[model samples]
Target: MKVHERLDQELSKQGKTQAALAEAVGVSSATVSQWRSGTKTPSATNLVKVAGFLGVQPSWLSYGELGGKTKTVDPKQRDAYRRECVWYHRPAPQDAGRELGNAAGFAFHGGLSTFGRETSQNILDEAQPGQPTVEARYTLIEISGSRLNSFLEAIKFDDLKPHLEAAADSRQKVAAVIRRGLSALADDGRLILLRVEDYGAKGLVGPEYDDGNYMAVVRNILDSFKGDNAGGSYGLGKSVMWACSQFGMVLINSTLSVAQDGKREGRYIGRLELPWHRLTAAEAGSPEAYAGPAWFGEKDEARGDVTRSYWGNEALALDTYLARDEDQPGTSFLIVGAYDPDERFQTIEDMHDELVRALAANFWPAMVERAGDDPGMMTALVRSERNGVTIKSDLVDPHSYTPAKARMLRMHRDDLTVDSLEQPGDVVRRRITLEVPKRLSDGAHGSQQHEAVLLVTEADEDDTDANRVAFLRGSHMVIREELVPGLRMGSRTFHAVVLAGLAAGGEPADKAADRFLRAAEPPEHDDWMVTPDVSSSYARGYGTALKNFRIEVRKAIREIVGRPTRDLSDGPDALKELLRINPPTVDTTKRPRVKSAVGKPDAEGRWSLDVRVSLPAREAPWRFSPVLRFGTDSGAAIPVVWEKLVPETRCTVTGDVVVAEAGAREVRFHGTSRADTHPVMASLATALVDVRVYKEASK
Candidate 1:
């Protein structure tokens, strides 16, 4: 390629216009255009300037020499380059008002667990094709003295300190958090940086401001370019990284699966999110009003003097503490001034444990190994360091952390599930249908029935989250978990998994179901319900479909693990008669009566009861208070206050009254007695419940 050809190619590849190059090189557009057209050759001085502007070697640009390789700028010249490579604060427009804080950062409450879950989901979403396992490692490092200063200098903390101080001076809600972070660094002279690295995944690729993962994550807000099966659709997951940083800053280093600018690794950039503020003319050389965010990179004069990512070398990566252990295709995020927003994790140990626990709890299925020789989708590790010394390194083992669920997933993958659980470790599989309504855009007549899988097995005695059904879809990350309702008393404690969409072995309707479920998820991606996306995209009855899907899942669980009916013949007749009260009698003239009641002692020693009431049909809603008392064998019944009452069906609970739906015959409500109000242990007492007509002075 000729000199003009190489120049033209670099210009096009870098998304730089001839006018931009001309302006940056202090030359006329006509001159640069002529040089591109091979009508003129640049002088040595302008050629070097042009090469520097385009990040190429002068010899490579002057001739087809050096294979047109990128210039590796020396670290000694960093200060000289720093003059051009500085933070670019976005100027606030005249018409718009100022922002107090970044709304996206507030999407999460800044818990370390939230950080782990969100970051891991992003890694799994970017899993490389044919890669057996995507690995995510979390490293927390505390540095002070010269080490801290060197790190801060690499990130140009001096340029950022002024902005942070200005934002904190405003005394806004976000400023309070900024103040605390500043105080910690100034008082303790130590700062903790959390570096999150992922391996075996597609890194942030594409142009700095175009439609790709890099732009979507770094430059935009609420713009997710993920596919239907991706765990995050809202694009708010990345904001949690900034939220975890007390200074609202995160630096990124990515090794791309696909090359950009003739390089595949050492892509470095930093983004700081702050509120609108103004810098004094004395400090900034000119009074400037900023709209909020700022970028740390070489100034791209081609794109309105905005900052774009720099292609650095190994030395630069090491200096920033973002050097990856291997040449893996993934991205690393370094959260500056890292601290748990909720303050639940104070020590490095607490943060490490929280990350491991969070990753296991939310992503155990993804970490579970398949049957036989196949590896799981992902693995994770959490470690802490102080001044280059490793304090703790924990490899999150899904089986060890969540044994029951992991076993259930393995059985599912191996097709080793049975029809019923007859003993310990027995896995039962059932098919539940999710009625996915046709999209409004489809113009179809009926809905697609997506078959979802439900796995249930007897939980280990030590499992704290037993007797709950965990719901997951394509990502294999738990979207939500709920205690199985309507299970019979003394039902075997078990763990259940509901696999929908692609997680259910990629059925014919998996794609459609995945799309529908993705639409149902909120920005948090924590639950599936009738969200705005679902309401606008799908036809009517989408909400009912989701509700039915949940109901069917619980019903299938009950059928597989519900306790069998007790045999009355096993007990003495007199004892049985005394123990069992007569069923509620039907009478048109009488008030409502309690038809059935079943009570069990919860882990907290509270008596939890499921009660059914029969009310005579009436035009007006029935108003009655449900009272709870402990039945004694030889004394008056002991009264206990109702701690919580939730209406299960055909009723609305207000205070102590159960208002049956108008014209409703039966009402089902669940209530728990206050443990503190109990005279004896809940296990030692029999629960008695009754319904009374509401009166003004009733108690």
Candidate 2:
């Protein structure tokens, strides 16, 4: 065999150097050089090693036939050698198209966006010149009855009782004992509640809906890092749910129907993941050594003891009581002792209200308007029973939620419309090409240059206005309403959405878009990553696109503001316009009365006075000035320290004072948005806290 020439050919094919191959084969460079130069032939053992390192059959390297057909060997040894030849030097499978580096492993099917840039480009090109005014209908989504279930006391123990008794072995007795022990526990004895916050407005639980890619997001992490077309590349988003639980864990319940053996079977899977600990360091083969992580459910004995479903497991009865008789397939998450890392909300109610309102702000368009090919008109219901009253907190249409927007909507709809929708005063949509930096050539998905679209709108007048645009890779919004360089449209607040098309020459645009989206976002999907200098081609591409978008926005703003406007201020019309611009404030004199008191014991034996504070949502981001005044039973003013309340949400706070006497403790939160000053100054709203102290604490 001309081994030297063959070695040279394989090296060239793999683009490997002699030194690299030598290191890989655990041989000296000189020996590899000599073998390649035909100066010497390796021994039989080394020859087999050489063939394996080159990912070729030893017989083929020794003789001249593929699959070692020309060589003779023992049948058993031949099969073993073939197996070795196939994988000994083979590298782990990888996607060359992805540039996510450490995040490359999360490119799974049904991940994020398949047609990111392509669809974005189509939308940009196909978007009509005018910004059409769309009408939206507002309604309430009431989620009554029990939306959750307790797993501790509710198990199919009767289904397993007969099996436990009929087991003609010790395994049966052990199973029966476990079942009896678990059955004796109360509902809260070992049970927890899981909250699954689905992305869109409509939670994943509806009759005509399918769980689709969301199921992958709930079930697995780092499983998506495979192909180029994955929707999400960073495996981090899946961990957000797990980390939300105080135990860094959660139990998942999903309904799935499968067809096996020509029979359609309905399956409800309850699964949980918990980290196992070892009491002490023991030898690897020890019977009770520490195991890292284990599934909490029934184990499949035939499959090397892999846990199946938690539902039929005797130790834990983890089936859902929330599943309906007319069952619509969806998912629920049970986070035992759920706690927020941000410390934004003190209780479950506060978190629910904050989340509902935040969702309304971020996805208002998707909820009110039809998002093409996506879930239509989303709704979320956060319901809980408190003090004999079932409180359901739901997101209403923006017109109903924000008072400022509600006022604007009340005006004649025709007056809000401009004669020409795409005219300067109406809206502007521009599709432009961006020049890429010259340094970004090798990593370029297409040519160094790419295309992007910019849209600017001057509709919707809310005083607490943020004029920012969203950066989109495809349909997936990379960055929410953010300001880019040169994007400041002064005085008049506006809304905008921008999209960038990215590409490198080797793959199709859609595939390139997948790589772009994967590399751009971190695992948590909070926002696009800000690590271009330290990241892969994907982040760098976004950086470049962002820079280009800023340039385009500056130009569009200049063109749009250059138009003339009609003067609507003449005598009586001027006064009316002034009143509309500077709205009146709510009268603080007629504040809500809080006469009830509720007290609970604190951990330190000190009585905790729970107060329900009512603060209405604001139309804009403004600081609230809260003034707390305390009065004694004899109508004497008592001094008290006012804690800074987070203006973002309404919450239940614990009052510090143990009032010996109480008449009225007033909290008036005032703001300047509704005032008639230049920057406006008026009392936006007030707050009332229901406090209960050890003594008389009612006001």
Candidate 3:
């Protein structure tokens, strides 16, 4: 925070005009205007007078120091200050309906890895125009005892405790999760906070509650104010942070690229999502019902008690555990009471690994540097701490995780791709034509052809998730990865990349393709398809064009790597005449075959298993139900029910069927069998698992 920022915020907060402040401080109104504009600083004597008039300490007004301390606010004034300093929105009594939970938060499957992907995309999308690279950091910190107590006091947790407790008693599904979060805090006396910070990017800049990045992220829902070329447009990505939090609360601190209120740093606020609930007059100051969402900031009484972001001081920021290390333009999101709903990341170390893996898998292109001078679009780092002790610190190296794909990206960036591959490490480039249809509103007659670049190379033996074509557009974020279809049996394993739009780096058609593919993306932005936006915007039969475009992409891949069919007629004539050569029989076993399985009994006597299954390539999604059993050497296997099933890669669990994404050759999942369902103790039995393809009963 700066002196001008402090002066401006205090003037608005106190409802005092600049002229009034100047009169009180014995200065001309023009002098005060200069002070507010940051053109001149107040003299020491004038500073004290100005502070006294505003009822704030001179040190705070001058340099954002609180009571002459650097990191601690006055303990006695903590609650009182928060009560008066921060605004908390309660539901209006005359509202027509109640919202149980945030629908946007539920849009994503709550997991740490998913959170990483969404946040990283947001960071990359906000990269500064001329900066070489944007830097993102993920920090997991555990606090307890005094440290935790101070944080709770700073945020005025008491103001929120009654609402959380009331919502928990309501017994809604989201409330049940909140109940467990409260229980864990009481039982362990600790809280885990996940802070995502980015540098070299645009921060939350604009009016506190109007049309700008600030309002788009902090004050509104389903309002993505990003450009057409940005990675995400659904405006739901930020909800992932709230979903990851066990407490449904997230705090924000941003340093704006453009100044707001004559200042550019320490813009801080917090938001809490809870179900609508009522409180008795005894529990709160008055009997009240809330409308499910609340904000933490300076209360604007003039605006129906709505809260707006506050210009935070160093002491306030440090106490809330949101102090940024640098003065760079970016934002930091602190997920209060953060926890992985999937339970895959039980320890900080697990979280560290997941963040790195997720980033490398989804944004390797943005992390790949070109040859000489130019840097990649972004860099990432992950750090973990327990009670202020560093447990792990990793600067993610994208090449280490996705070597083949990263190499291709580097080659593409440097324009080093060859026409065909002749040796190992060679990248082959070709053009796949995409027929982009004219928009329905454009009044155009025909479609335009856009050339999308396709890069392919032989995959390294150790490369994981190889032989898949990654789709990217203007943002260079992977939209989806799928195996190329129509490849001959025994085709060499390879890695492929389809770069369209600006990522293709040439031709005016790039912009047209970018707009087309962007409109085709759903809210998750995971894949491009025939979406409502696409249907309403494009001409008739646009879906067919999209289908053909995908087909052409696959056809190009096959041309690059598919082996030629063998000629049976070349064999001995007598043998060939007698032999019945089947024309490439298709594998009808849609069921995934278990390639490997491992398990162990946990302390609760439940069998925990990690299984990998391989499937035949197909355009349609494969659906299967995993069956768990206890096996014996010479006896019938006993069936067991799974207590939990978590998809690990390229699959999703819906109802009872695990739907593997189309073109997935293999998938991995983790399961824990119900101990109660076991015929005997899990430790005394061998776990057997099978995946059965789901079949619809014939009428």
Candidate 4:
């Protein structure tokens, strides 16, 4: 039957007047009359409304086909027939050899209702660490209205409103329902649909691997390591992009670097919507069915083979929606149905903030040119706003410490040097080395360790603080602030910012240290887990090298922070030397005032003296130890007694001297090591007595 006859028949069956049908469809009565008289056809929008008004499917009004339900025949069979009718009845394509029907075939057996805002977001969270790098401005535009109608010819399925939401288990449903509803959202001015534009030197060109079948390698290629020191273990970052879209659907449009014909023709368009149905081999392979993955770019019908598949951007659909005139070499991701408002990406500002923060945390070093796995530089630019509110890594982010900290470290690179641990290994395969630079600065020196830039500054592995060390590999700071068990120092917590590189100390890769450092790194590049398991020679070597590094760090710390010293000597000028050693640091302005000693040599040979010393109360914490410096003599032993007397054979007497509340103390000297020699007592007093005690150690 003619389309007008079908419309007339449906109106009569529903007992609806032409005027009532026109009113229901938001059309003029004259237009309805023209449609009924076969003078004109209704637009795709009005056709759907008129069909609904007459209690029929739009396919019935447009193509004289039955609705999805049937009594005598099976409902599944009838639904299948209706889908076929819709495809065949689609208006003839002005462009030859383009199969728009393939878009519908990719729908799975069960509807794609399993994917939603929350479900998709979960996938994104797990896959964030592996996102790809493209230096470009990524723009997401919210579009609707007649702009959606323009896709009717390329996308084939016209009335997508009903199928937008179907039963989760309903299989063999139309493919375009979700897309239609998202496009229809123009009526409400909501940003349900989004077109993502990734612009710059690198675009989203179609993959040239896996025999030009991107599906075979899209998910698998991510597993390969882009760099030895890169942070991610598995390359699943792109999965997050699909997860953010409703029904795991997105259109990829980009110009490839591959050349075809005489020119560098590389423009290509493709769709990455995993199939929903369990299709037959023929259906899965047919471009018309588009049952799994499909290419929708320029095709040369003359070729009449797989090579004829449009691998360039000559297709009108690709050109109109993707802005082919930009002439840039980046790709655009068209997320037909973007996720609804969520906690993380509720508004454009929210999205901008979240993405920028993530980038700074994981990729700041690369973004700011501090480090990168590739020789060619790559940076991230997210433009969620239409008015150009861009987030850059070079700017200081108050909430995040990575970007600003890394930038500061780059400025002080001269102060940093690669510390290494030497070990036994082949000259070319050595790996026991740490690349993080250790710097000693007055501002960063104190009783408490100061935080270092580009290093984990926390002691707790699970906690975020500026007191620990980060393990660096490739160009990434893989493990942040991992506490080394061997670095502990009694009750005093030891903190440091440590890192290792591919090589240290100018050692070749064959050296044991170099091999150990590289061998200890896990595939994930998160931590150094060198073990003593002999079965793995590399692991054992790594473990040994790591132990050496820990010991070196301990030694270095001790040298930086001096230890207490105790020495005694007896010479003619020993007293003078003792006085000099007593004061750790001599500041003329704050020297301790020493009064005179009141005693002379006694006949009994016991040296005794009453010494008076005055010190500021704040210096009370400084304890004084006295040493006796005797003249060079072979005569007899001299011992000094404060708490215990020393024998005469020892020329010098060193002991802790107790001071009374009156700032006076008594000292008796009878020269000898109490354990070895005879005692010779001498009583002496001299104004040159050194009364200065302990001085605080300074850096």
Candidate with best lDDT = 1
Can you list the residue pairs that collide in candidate 3? 87-297, 91-290
Expressed as tens digits, the lDDT of each residue in 99-175 for candidate 1 is: 88878888875699889889999999999888777878888988999989888887788878988988888868778
| Residue lDDT tens for model 2, 255-296 | 333222332212223322222222222322233322222333
Instruction: Tell me each candidate's TM-score.
Output: 0.70, 0.44, 0.69, 0.42
Query: Model 3's lDDT to the true fold?
Result: 0.76
Lowest lDDT block of 10, candidate 4 = 421-430
Model 4, span 1-699: residue lDDT tens: 776999888778778898766445434466678889976655433454566567665544554421122224345533332333221111223443323223322322221121221112122222223333333333444433454444433443333222233211234322344444445454554443344443333332234433332332232334433333333333433444454555445555555443334233334344434333332344333322223333333333463322222334334324234434345444555555555323236454555455545445544443332221111123433444232222221221211344223422332232221221110000011122333211122222112111112221111111244233344433433344454444322211223433344312232321332233334554333445653321254322334445555555444533322222112233212234455655545333333332222222322333333333334334233344443322212422233333232322112234544332322232222211122122332312111234445554211
| Residue 121 lDDT (model 3) | 89
Cα lDDT listed for each candidate: 0.78, 0.35, 0.76, 0.36
Better of 1 and 4 by lDDT: 1
Q: How far is 640's C-alpha from truth in model 3 (Å)?
A: 63
Ranking of candidates on TM-score, top first = 1, 3, 2, 4
Q: How much is the lDDT of residue 96 in candidate 3?
A: 49
lDDT of 3 at 143: 88
User: How many collisions per candidate?
Assistant: 0, 24, 2, 74
Looking at model 1, report the run of 10 residues with the lowest lDDT sum: 565-574
* Candidate 1 accuracy as lDDT: 0.78
